[model samples]
Target: MSAYSASPSTPRTTSRTPTPPRTTVVNVEEFEMDGRSIETKSADHVPIVFKANPFKHTYPILRHTCFGVQGKQTCEVRDTTTNPMFRDMEEDDPQIQYVAKPFRSKSVQKPYRLRCGVMNYAWGKQSTDSAVAQWMQEGDPTYQVEQRPYAELWVGTHTNAPSYMQESTGSSSNLVSENSSFANQSLHEFLQRNPATLGDAHTEQFGTDLPYLLKILSVATALSIQAHPEKSHAERLHASDPDHYPDPNHKPEAVVALSNYKAMCSFRPLPEIAHHLQTIDELRALVHEDMVERFVTVVGSDGSSVEAKKEALKSIYMELLLCDSARVQQSIDAMTARLRNSTDLSWVESTFLDLTVQYPGDGGCFQVFFLNLIELKPGEGLFLAANEPHAYIHGDAVEIMARSDNVVRAGLTPKFKDHKVMGEMLSYDTQPLHIFRPNNEGPLTSYCPPPEYPDFKLLRVSLTEEWPGVSYELGKSSGCLLVTQGSATLLYCGKDCTIPTARLEVSVGSAYFLPSRLSVYFSRMTDFVAFIGECQIRAG
Candidate 1:
């Protein structure tokens, strides 16, 4: 017997008899169908028939009636029904009352494929050597790689370069066929129309715009030594010089190594920097003698507070940046000549030579001694706050940051350098580099940022052959997922269906925009790895 089966009922009479209407409350999910609100009342049966439409293929709308008896509510189809739209339904079900209305489809509220944008910077790797180029080729078969370098693959709704919708997935054949205009729409435009995808709490907190931008970077050479301004300073810079400072937003970034990666992070420990300044004659020549003496004295004194040490470091750094250009070049030349003649050189000396070769006579070359030079293995990560000076030296990595592009360059580039602003804005607190280690749980590893930076988090899913399938519940926040390795079959089963209503076959480099509160299952053919970038807003 069926679970919905009930005892036999008497037949209806032709003679009409009026009865007083009474209110009764029953528990059941409510939704609109054919422009009518479905509600339960004090009645034995209220038949319903879902109109056939494009969404019928995507959403599972059942044909049933509510039975309210003795304060109890149950749903069942008590008789057979015949309709051209529902010929596949069971013949024994009760007849349903059909309401005629024009068919209308709801806004998109599910995962869809995305086509991200790519940037070609000079520091990027050339041709297929770059992971960004390779991923671009994999995602778009029509894309052709040229001789120029490919640097970053941007996956967000930043105004400079926004991602577009490639395709939408579901069982809705009419939606896919008739509503083809949804494809190729910018993600920013889509979010404007459908704010629910970002969740109510997120939209309220972050204002409908995506809070973070995800990027895949392939570095072949050293990038410019730069720092991003804080929120207040960014606004001031943008208002004063809009060309150089493109946006009025701070950019706090975190990077996870996809391969062996080398980068210059925050300033080194006070003792280490003081030692280098005292020993390295070439480095000490650029800064003023008085400023260097004060910095060394402050750093060496045990009684000096952290704030005093930071002020002293800032004084020396500013002197170095504001020094005469000819003296900076002469210092670079002296360092190069000495390093070439010396047989034994430390990594710091070797890196200094490399920077001088890449960017000759640029004062940024001396930053190697002042900053912490760190190398990260695969899976290792680092977080850089706003106003902290850093540069990516080489290798591939996944970088996520606030949606902004306001960089104050110090050197190593032909672009406009804001040396004065860069010097004043830097947070010259010399501390050891703290590497972020992900919290691992089975096949999933979460790279959560510090509590102060609650804008975004990264989740990495690694599926091995032994554990080939996993279910991911997105809870109540939207996110973008990119497949970095292998391939998998994704299944999305709606709330009312026992089987999947949408199935997508994804391969390496594929990216999808996942809606809020959606659960998806993945079945892999082989070892697979994917990263999901999501906002950290709390659900309301």
Candidate 2:
């Protein structure tokens, strides 16, 4: 895989010229739709295409089958009176199986199934069993592969390269490390081998891996309330208990809405949390005055509720955890019962009861009272640096963050639900979390939010009409353009361009490599959009 190269204001020249226009253009052939020939205009536009598409893509549409298996459910690690954490909501829960496995089969039978020059399954594209079998054909070498699958298309390597199917090709393809592809591979090992398709200089400077990782998320269901530790604190905890703190670093993430997004971020200020806490008659039974006093002290006039809530939480948690199963269950039952009957605050009754039914015997049911609830429209995004507690409630989005998988959990999960561990790993000093909005409105925002990752940035291009015009200069970072609708054209060095198929182009999705520093792009379409992200590029 090639890393990004420096911009070449003047690219190396190739010698290919187009023929002069004729008085009357001849129709090459009637356009085919529904297996029939449809007439076209005199000047037909050729969409962009790719040869040996390089975008490392997958369409593993994950579905929730979380109700079944309790044995395989993530067991609770907390010493609480009652284990309130649930296994169904955890992402890594073993029994929680994903419905569709996108990376298993290799046959490229269908083109559109692979969105963005890469492979991705968002909304259901696999209906018939026959179609599923046919689409799996891309993995089959026997099927014919073509050059220029779509018009104005791009495909190549970037800093974050995908792991290729090993033992089969001996050489890896340009793609990222997907769970399906590298189920047995360590995330660190995969990064070591692929080394973000970056330039040699960057490889020398920043080492192989980039500081950040990006993800495309489709939330079929709500995520559990959670947060991550700060950097230094995380390192120390991992040293003390390697089994509990898997990685040595902290996790800070940002999510941009690709579809409608919903979440509960930081808890309301102490006054609000205290306000909400007061209305709950079960408060005295669940916590102590010392904890209440500590919370009141921190909820000081500053208006930052996160610090006080987190501090007071550590104390309240230690108290509840002192008892065994029976006592804990009694406390949990009382709180839940209060939520069901209290008409004073509908939010407490409704949200709490909904969680009780959804998670049954889990303690994280209490987290709903302590977070900032929000609904994100398409194109909007949320940024959570280290120690900021957050969770996705519903909807799907594109996620980007520093390239580390280290995470610390507090409640809302059965696996390792250790608040002491989480509290110790966090940065107690709190600040307001920021959200980003698009410069324009509508689906374009859904397509692209303001760039979140400092290492990699993203932009959106619309092709709903003819091709929308966008001016960009490929400086040092190599980049890719992903086509999501109609078709487009890539004018390479001004000539030698080809038309690619819409479905075929799907495999290339949102990633492409820029080799010669810079190239200009133009488009033609019916209704389409493209997401452009910076590739791992550097001065040669």
Candidate 3:
């Protein structure tokens, strides 16, 4: 049993290379099909072959079923071609005898190479400055870094920007295309045909596709201040206006910083907001005097329930969001002008001025005072639940979310704004954003979310010279892996008590689609760091 196995109860071994299966020998004569005669010295080496039908290219010419004979210690091979698509197939056929052995199914799941899509949004970091671009370039030699900004690298089966699986052929791998029988296929299409890859629990809950979308973001400027709708609200929005809503799925996302990162997330704590409201005269000027006084009074009251505080916060936020654009702009101009010459300024005040310069007169500038201004060092993370407003300010990060693109933007973007929806959809929870720290378990650092969010969880693998290897049990969920640094060799062992069936060299920016119910071993050649996004399987 390997020490890195997921559990002691499930003992498994690992090897640098695969062990060949034992074989039995039997004698057989040469067989001919479509004028092609294949000879074997003994039946032990005769291979089962399928030839493509010329007329019906989609269907194969022959199908064989082999069963072991008890007394003879050999196998009887029979043709079971019953498809109506095959023309002139004979029912009476001679059975060929051969040595029986364990047969592997063609439908068995294996790791697949992926070609992810890149988004070049204006807020993205430019070319080589962008981690998204650098990773994409490393994974794909064909990708060229242009002068344009590269914002995100999306890895999922979303129809908006689906990832394509590359088919390995001999020494080269090619992107699966429509013309090939099954070589080039979108991740969504492939999952439709092989739902088992998603695991039974995930497939039962989320259907054929992945419930989560993984992304690598490179932020040079601020993203739009936005909130995602809840499931029911998303369905309604998609039904009424799909042009903006796109998909009928809610997005609850989390981001793990890869560099020094900054963002505005959720609502500030009641006391914090109360303090800001009391001190920032310019922010207080945007909302009505009555609303501001009511918010401060409610927050300061010890008898107030959490629900009461939430209502108070919501009222204040809605007042600010619904304020006239001219009035909001006037307040922002006053605040920025006053803070410009101040020698001492709080982080929040500095962020407000920066946003003002980027998006002058935008209402999101005022939002800084209302939301928690969070700064995350590398590996630190925060979850933004559905209906919670957030906007990435700067830096690089890897993010995972419930598969959705439904964003209701209010400000700081040239994109369409839905101030009414944004105001109504916000949860207005005033708890300070909780920073997630990965729980270290050997070489694996797990960032598992609370049980309420069962869509996805992230695992970070760090391999150093001191601890050069690790094994991960895929259990009952499919996962996507992105190698962000250094190099390693992967040994893929599917199911339990099985030797590795495949071995591949992986390096920085290499990405793979790992199938469900497999154990994968990684041996580091150099320091390695990779992130795996898998469906969260709750334990009973």
Candidate 4:
């Protein structure tokens, strides 16, 4: 079922009953850009489409040399290698990387529809159960649901999953056939050619990359128990293990629930850990008696140094994690049997029994004791630190993370588990349960992420005809915007806001790459909502 297909609060632009295609287009939505309301008489712009060429084939499509909206119509034709944004993106002091040659093509920028990639990782949801799949279903008639697990919809450029814009010439979404693939160049490639579009701020801070990677994660089963290394550690690990670590960037991420979202994040609080360690015989039986005694003693003691307490926790966790694999399985079996026979129930007990079935005999079944369980209802959000051990248990969420794939596994996965590296990298510091809320108020809400990972930020923008417009000052960098509600239009300009650019109609499931360095005001919209992901580049 499409979660955003219909809601009482959301306004629909389509007709009540479906009919055959009409040649003429109707301009029903109003526009408010640059603070002035303009009546849209027509939508003369053509809808762009791209088709996949089955056999290895390349097409000569138009390339816009410009990055920002201002420069899209023209290009100064700067070399990408010398573009400072291209040079500074990675901290390794490399001159430039990832960008392919044939730098800038000679063509004017015309609006193109973005076509992102689909990730079918094993843990993903299947059929109608996938939010990623459902979002892809938007405006796509040829999208068919296969029985395979559809895990994530990648909306950024990270090599593993990069979105592409429509480069080929085509009519409307209706006219696009299966053979026509929309992706001509990866968004990363486009950014390399036009760094200005990302704006001065992002280019100066993170260079060519849009510091964050946005994804729609639809989980049918629990993800692997994992922790991402910090920047320095990431560089070291990547140097050691390039196959898995891939990028030297840290992966501090945030998740906004699309549906009821469940996850196991970080380690459990000390008090909770003590209670379970003492009460849960299954845990006590597995860890070293001395280590267990030490943890209980410190936690039981009144005054202990932060380092002392952390060290105690580290000892207990390592004992549990590195315990004999067979004994670990045995203890888990014991817990499951106890859970099945016992009448008393608890969240951990139930969760344990459930996940055990998903990943039978895995040590993570016992490792659950060392983690915090979190549930986020729709609209709720939370940030996950790079050092936090987290596993997405189930449910759907829109996730944004630093553009890195450097995950060190602990357990709960069929993939290789780097237990030693995970132990070294995991943050044992306990934290109280945290739920993210919009820090900035008004028509556009901003959920500020933690300072540790300042590469990316998120914004929730809402619009309506009555409150038709909301304005945001232009920053050095632009953002990646995804519309989740009603249709609307956006315009960017200076403070006087008199002269506006062409009205860009934003509809449901619509995604746009906003150029940097322009204040934007949205109008001609009602009950509209959207999420914007961008790099957090500070003004010097």
Candidate 3: RMSD to truth: 12.5
How do the residues 354-430 of candidate 1 rate in per-residue lDDT, one tens digit apiece?
98888888888898888899999877889888899999999999988888999999977778888899999998866
Steric clash pairs (candidate 4): 50-180, 50-181, 50-182, 51-180, 51-181, 52-180, 52-181, 67-197, 68-197, 201-476
Instruction: Please list the C-alpha lDDT of all candidates, in the order they appear.
Output: 0.72, 0.43, 0.73, 0.66
Candidate 2 total steric clashes? 56
Q: Flag the better candidate by TM-score, 1 or 4.
A: 1
Model 2 error, position 485 (Å): 6.3
Q: Residue-wise lDDT of candidate 3 within 1-540, one digit each (tens)? A: 112522112222222211112212233322333422221211332122222223222212222322221011112122224333224333353322121222344544567877788899999999999999899888767888999999999999877778887755444222211223445689889889978777887777778889899999999999999999989999999999999999898898889988899999898778888888889898888888888899889988999988899888888888887889899888887888899989999888889989999998888888887788888987788887889999999999999998999999988998899888898888888665767875454567777677788888888887775556667768878899888888887766564323345567777776778878766777777988889998777664
Superposed model 4: Cα runs more than 4 Å off: 1-112, 168-183, 438-442, 463-469, 491-497, 523-527
For model 3, give the 10-residue run with minimal summed lDDT.
69-78
Q: Candidate 2: misplaced stretches above 4 Å?
A: 1-162, 165-197, 237-240, 297-328, 335-349, 428-430, 441-463, 471-474, 478-526, 529-540
Q: Can you write out model 4's per-residue Cα lDDT over 43-73, one digit (the tens) per residue?
A: 2211111111121221111122112222111
lDDT of 2 by residue, 296-325 (tens): 666654664565556675565455434344
* Model 3: CA > 4 A from native: 1-108, 169-181, 538-540
Candidate 2 least-lDDT 10 residues? 67-76
lDDT of 1 at 335: 78
Pick the lDDT winner.
3
Which residue pairs come into collision in candidate 3?
176-184, 177-184
Better of 1 and 2 by lDDT: 1
Query: Alpha carbon lDDT of residue 497, candidate 4?
Result: 25
